[model samples]
Target: MLTNNIIFYSDESSIKISVNKDLFNKMYQYCDKSYPNETGGILIGTYLDKQTAEIVAVIGPSEDSKTWKTRFNRGAKGINKLLKEYWEQGIYYLGEWHFHPNGSPYPSNIDTDTLTSISNNSKYSCPEPILIIISGSHNCYNQKSYLYSSTGQKFEMNC
Candidate 1:
């Protein structure tokens, strides 16, 4: 588990991501609540610069979302409303986060495809999106962060 805020940089140094300890704990709690079933939510934060983002908040799984042992289909329920509220606080939608339960933090093919779709979707209004995948149990957890571009490029963020 993460005890402090961490910073990650892409291999190309094109982007930087910062995740705080509180947010990490919150994601852990959400993952714990779902247990064997996969669960996920949206990430909300602001850009510190053209290439840097600091994750400040996370919205957990929606009521309409579908969660299976190996797959999670995030629903759109209440997300627009939540995004509007967060926008008032200057917290824009940064990307998404999910738990893999006993699996690796690395993203699967579906994840990559979904992220690419999100990047191209104007409804999201984010040309590039970030993804955070958390895996493992309460005692020992792992996390991987990725950035996806509208051009179908994926960048893995490194510590």
Candidate 2:
């Protein structure tokens, strides 16, 4: 069940965001190679069956800014484009994703702030957007994925 603007799906929960394996790899590379410090992107998807949110795509910034670590957000202009696309179809911003160098994939204080800002900034916000953290770049397939709640209040899954 969803409460306080947070939802999850497991082939059982109401909201389910379908993840694309190919796109997941891209996000991983963004952090593991191009930007070892931090990598971020947007989650694109359609609202499903009036219950779950299924992630359909990913969009990363061609530009970025360093914030103690690197940060990526869709530019305002790009977001406008995305909004128009969403309206045309019926989908909207699903959530946000990023990388964690060595932290436990847990929500750091800063992470909580970011999530809060996202939730409060828009009328189209989900109870919580899917927050993904890729960790354990210690080697290769050993990478772990952590899913944080929309509010960055807790881990929805292990990463």
Candidate 3:
């Protein structure tokens, strides 16, 4: 069963990430499968307001993705097709989610750079993207989410 809602807040913004409990469990399962390696996926949802959004689905790592102990590079294979399908179902691309494997939930330099690049990319058309990082192994996982703006502002999500 899915929960009714999950709230993430900050001094500057508040977002209601709507994810079913089943989906949330599945996300953890993905991390369990990856274990010591890194794993990531896209977040599919819709914006409710300027400072609010809903997470409807999470796409797991692709077969072609590159995963390592300290890094994760999401593959492009079939992503477009998946996005299109989700779009048809009224779910838009909101941002990304990944696991840190054996690290903290804090975003690293590479993570920051990736968020900046995503915000700046004309193809994405998302000036602000949400990032969710799950740190630690399956036995003891810690999750943190953030919102990164194109102007280089980062806000930690408080749940």
TM-score for each predicted model, relative to the true structure: 0.94, 0.69, 0.91
Residue 40, model 2: Cα distance from true site in angstroms? 0.4
lDDT of 3 by residue, 11-85 (tens): 776545555556667778999999899999988888777656788788999889999999999987998898888
When 1 and 2 are scored with lDDT, the better candidate is 1
List ranges where model 2 is wrong by over 4 Å: 1-14, 62-64, 67-77, 138-155
Q: What lDDT, from 0 to 1, does candidate 3 have?
A: 0.83
Better of 2 and 3 by TM-score: 3
The 10-residue segment of model 2 with minimum total lDDT is 1-10
Q: Candidate 2 lDDT, tens digit per residue, 30-52?
A: 76663446666777788667755
Cα lDDT for residue 24, candidate 3: 61
Quantify all predictions' global Cα lDDT against the true fold.
0.90, 0.57, 0.83
Clashing pairs in 2: 5-127, 15-52, 18-55, 144-159, 145-159, 146-159
**TM accuracy, model 3:** 0.91
In candidate 3, residue 145 scores what lDDT? 85
Best by lDDT: 1
